[model samples]
Target: MGSSYQLQQQAIDAEIRSLEGSIRALKLRRNTFAPISSLPNEVIAIIFSFLRARVTLFAIKPGKKPDGLAWLRVAHVCHQWREIALNQPHFWSHVDFTAVSSAGAAEILSRAKTVPLHLEVGAPVGLWDDARFGPFQKELQDRVPHICRLAISAEPFHLHRILKGLIMPAPTLEFLSLASENDHRGGAAFVPDSLFDGSTPRLSSLELWNCDISWMSPLLGSLKHLEIRSPFKWPSLSVWLDALDQMPQLKTLALHRASPVAPWGLIPSEVERAVTLPSLTHFEVSSPARYCGFALAHLILPALTSLCVVAESSRRDYSDVQEILTFVSRHAHGPQDSRPLQSVLVRSNGMGVEIVAWTSPDVHVELSEQISVSDARHSGRVSFSITNSDDWSPRVDTGTLSAVMEALPLDGLVTFTAQNRFNRQFWLWHAPKWPLLRHVRLTPAAERGFREMLMEDNKRRGGPLLPLLKTLVLVDVALLERRNLRLCDALTKRVEQGVPLETLDLRKCLATGHAIELLSKIVVDVLAPEKTYETGSDLVSEAGARLIYVEDEYSEVEDYDEDDADTGSDDEVQDMDGDTSSDIYGEGEAVYW
Candidate 1:
């Protein structure tokens, strides 16, 4: 009886297995008839490539590992997808050891076949210790000849070992980036002379962070892009010049705290010869003002289209500021002098001061439209930023800033934007320098001082200040009570002098009904916020108070975007007014009370 029962159970299990097989067959057949399955194999492979391309292995937060293999879920969707993904060697060419387990790494390597691999390893700090990294290290050592791009972020000891293992020639390598996870200066890793056995012919881009290499390394010969941050040691000025002379094809060079230290008793005549970088278009340096000035004095960039200098100091004297300004004045002309300076924006606060000059008026239009300058691409720009580290709430050095403005070649400037607070004296003193200025945008903090300057200029017996000024923009300012009356009086004086403003824009400002009436009467066209809060009873609405508070918070902040200088083409100016048609700023007609 027991045998009979066992036989019955076995028979039932066999039938269940048969049913499962049938079910899988039916699903496969159904998938074949689906819309996506009808796509040609090559088209399907292209779609898969795009999906894989979107998954990157960078920028993972702390205490987390990269999951770049998530795109492989497409292979599990159907049998056909699995076959297609396995057949395409390029799909599995990128192997991130930290993201995959030991078995998974083997599978990826097997599937990649002979395709040139783009390898990323040892990121997110604590993941790649010596024990767990041994097998992968061996694999990388064997595959160095096939790597196209390699980026590794590891601690000093581990990086040293990894570099020692990479002694073979890497003829296929094009891009290489090495970073030390340890922040201590003493913990920087040393690059061995045998790296790629000094035989990387295709190398074009190299970035080293906290790594020390010889200045005359063969790997630095023909690089097009070079970025070094926090190097183990700073070379002398002459050594840097010699290294730069080797890379005439370099297009972008960025150094963060990696510039040469200032030598004592250095005279201008000692380093009269400047290393000319003819192909350099974008140059950036962040260091002490003295070091930055010393570095800029020794290099000549004839093809430079973008320049960025960030100077930080604790001294009261601003001689370094003058040196930097001199460099900018020399290079303000765009590449080959094809584009001239057209717009300038100055932003200052307790923490720092930033000045940006562009060769196109459209940058001002884009700023007026509230597009972040950091995201825009342009051809010509010169930017400067200086900060004081002694005091967080220190007063702005108007004396130094005035010199900076005076040094700028503003004869061709057409648009100017001033943000944050500047004392009345600063504006009154420098207002006349911008004779060709046509468009001006002033933030809330700047509005009062600028109004005072205009009023004071009216009192003088000379010509009107900013005689070419056509458009005036007041952003996040309060136009209520006494402030409104004083500003209107200033505008009335301008109108009386026969230099009426063509357009008046009040953006995100709280104004009483009487204020808009007075402004509309003086300006030909008024652009006010869509929703205006009339504070007739001296009671502010919640939203209006919130706006004022936000503006106040931003008043002491440095709002300059560095990326704006390196981007934006000549064609982007055509769409600068794309946001003007929106209802946020109301119609182009006057706003009645």
Candidate 2:
């Protein structure tokens, strides 16, 4: 017992000694560090403030190390950090409780103090019920009037209670994003005008996804930016189009992503005359693959600096290219001060191709590329967009694609983008030589045609195929059964032609070992002839491109069905412009091999 008492006394003595040492150091060092300690409090506070806000309150689940996660990890470093974190009330408002717990939520809200909050709740339907939120609900209700922004993503049933329970109004709320990934969860009743009543006098922006709302009420007056997706199934587009007529202050409007196959043509003027929105400047509309159907020129904003149309391409050939071309022509900036209708993105969903143009002409392509000896020599980042470059389809081959690339002016383009722009069969005249070409993006089907095109048999008076081709990118390449003369044969032919092929990059997409074996042949043949093709178990093909191949094994899933492939939505309606919406497109017949 005497020995145990000695041990406990020794621990107490050590703690007391440490405290005395700290006190002695503080008293002696106060004068020496006075200048540093006297630094501006606001600046010191900012430095500490930065440390506090770095704590991440929410991370995207299945969380990879993104910026959000990195920021959150910075908070747990030390004791000083924990103190600075609790002191800054604004830091608590940015708390994202997507995958956090209820208790964690209360802690976050508590730390936020009385500062206006920005709350984003992304929880599954069952997780955020009125009962589940009962404890925080009342507290949130009490704090609602102080909230600056509130974004809640829940089902329709829960949304009703949430809207009703919102502490009798947030007059300062400025932004709201409400939706459910599960479409059936939101409807008109959940978004009654009373939700955006005078209490929310400052609400300026609204974004909806898979929300079902009829905009027949008086919620349209002061909105500056209004975005709607899946406009109806809450009812119809007409309900909101009716409200837009009265929104005099509206500046930006984004329509729902229309069905790829739906007969959505240029809406005529008479239909648009219902509302005169003189203040509108930015407009985004989703169209079917082709640009033929709908017209929006009548409501064209005189002050419009940017116009974006995401059109579905029905006719792969140049039938309505003129219509889209004309729309672009009509909307191009006239004044030098005007924004140069700059970017255009054409993505193919199903067979219905989408053409979305960005109005800022000065913008570079958003796609990345390989830097060449030449690009490095020039300087800076080389961005490329599929829509800006040549044809970027997943079902086309690189070697054969060169022919299509022949039509573009490639003097300034990078080699790979220049090569892909004309996916496979690049005509000899266009690429006379591959300067920037590095990779070719394609699917297994294109791989087959590519192999066949390179066969000693496919002699069509063309020289060697894709001599400069190096890599192949499969963005959404699906892992499916093989159809081939082998990727080995394809690589070997490039080698035989003395063409140097290097990497077959399909990092984002997957293929089989057997497919990998074929790609691995570049070293044996093209890269270093002394090397041999080492086979592996990888599939060659991936599926993002719309494809339909008539072969031994066929499944509805394997077929690249255009969104237009099969649907009862084909029954058409005439637009206000006296144009037959169905004239340009008809039924989808089986495509023969």
Candidate 3:
């Protein structure tokens, strides 16, 4: 009987093996007829374009297999894909000389045939000294005329040699960006006019970082977009006007850290006259805290729709802020310029202070050091931002923020979004009122401040602060029952006082189900009934932008106020337009407000 059992087992094993073989064969046949393999070359070409779009090719290490290049992976997929990719000249147009394999780049160049090339040539840190760049340099010389868009970030010496080697003008070049690999503050290499023999008429957009160019360079004549950064020699105000005058079609101009050669406001009278840019629409300037307003003070942009100014200073400098405010007031109220500013963005991050304010035609005003913008024109809402700055040295004095608020119209403001705790401090200090404010979005830190501000107003019998505020949006804020009971009480008191907060939307909030239930009884509508939801990871808030600090050595946490009873009497609603006094972080500390 044992022998019979062994024989039976052997027979079963043989049957299983036979079945497995048949299954393998079937799978192979099915894969051979797979839908993807049967796709037409035209269809595959479209798929290849989508896959290879925006790919930045880098030089492949000698022995290591290239990993990130999508074209290489596609070519290796199958013979058909390789053939289709190699035959398409446009597919090989964008070449990154820095990371491309010596042999691989040549192959791509050959396949690229007569297609307009977009070349990026740069070597990272240690690779700048490598001998492999010799061949790539020669290839670049051969391909310059065909290059339509070129971006080079290399050692200044290497850049100089490369530009010097261009024996012919790049007739096809339209956009050019040349930047130094090293940080050479005031020692940028001078780009000689003879590099292109004063040719390059098609160039419309030019960006230079840590490089020198003559103000009279022919390249500036037809440029529509010009960006100059950390120029070695600060061009005289008159030189700037002359250069701008040559570019009739210039629309967007940005000058970053380009201070005047002379002291601030000492430009010659001729250069000081405002030069009008008829086609200019967007203007951006960032300069040292002391001279952030230098460029705008010298130019006039009548068609300007968007303006962004960032004043950066390492030490305390109030002059920069004052200059910015003065510049805006002068241009915004000028009678000759009837165009209402569609948007205004001003920020100062220097020393120990940070302040950001953004306003547009549709939205009235936003103020706080933390960045946030709300686009609720359809809903008629405005937003605000706030954040705590550690190492708060009070540099780049924000006294200008209050002045900015006073200069703008805030009566129609409807929505306010607050981000960080310090924003609450800014708000309490400013005590600005928007009679039409109806919706408010708050983080936990700001929530406490909001409650306190509202409770302070509830104490007095005068017109309420934010009387029309009906909706409250809480984002990623936790409510502790023991400590935050007063928050609920404040809402209850405000509701009882007639300015009822109709909706309480708990979004991505960490509140206990019981706490949410309790709050539901107070507010008419409570969102997030589930009491839990993942917070949105979007850094950009509803307001459009928010400023975040990566490193702040000092931060403090305050306990939530749990007291439900109104302990203090209401303070009369102070006029937002008038100067108001309030304690800053300490009893006697004075702030910009």
Candidate 1 lDDT, tens digit per residue, 425-523? 555455666678888887765665577667654444378878888898887676655567777888888888778888988865666677788889989
Q: In candidate 3, residue 473 scores what lDDT?
A: 77
Tens digits of per-residue lDDT, candidate 3, 1-593, equal 99999999999999999999899688657655878978888998989987865633222112342333565578876557788887888888887776678787888788888788887766664565546777778888888788888778777777777778876788888888888667443245667777566678788898887788998888788899998887767778788778888887998887776755436553232343767888887666666544545666777777765555555533343433544555644443333333333322232323333322324333323433222322221112111111222356453223445455544444545555544343334555544446666777665545655676766553443666777778877765555555347668878888777887899887555555667767888888888635331233343342221122111112222333324334212223344333433323333322331
State how far residue 409 of model 1 sits from its true place (Å): 2.2
Model 3 spans with C-alpha error above 4 angstroms:
1-44, 55-68, 183-187, 259-272, 313-319, 329-400, 407-411, 420-433, 456-462, 475-478, 528-593
lDDT of each: 0.72, 0.46, 0.60
Sort by lDDT, top down from the best: 1, 3, 2
Clashes of each: 4, 58, 17
The TM-score values for the models, in the order shown, are 0.83, 0.54, 0.73
Model 3, residue 275: distance off in Å is 1.6
The count of backbone overlaps in candidate 3 is 17
* Highest TM-score model number: 1
lDDT of 2 by residue, 335-410 (tens): 4223322232222223222223333332232233332322321221211111211253232223212212222223
> Least lDDT summed over 10 consecutive residues: which range in candidate 2?
380-389
Q: Candidate 2: which stretches are off by over 4 Å?
A: 1-38, 49-82, 128-131, 181-189, 196-198, 216-218, 234-242, 257-281, 287-298, 311-351, 356-593
Candidate 1 or 3, higher lDDT?
1
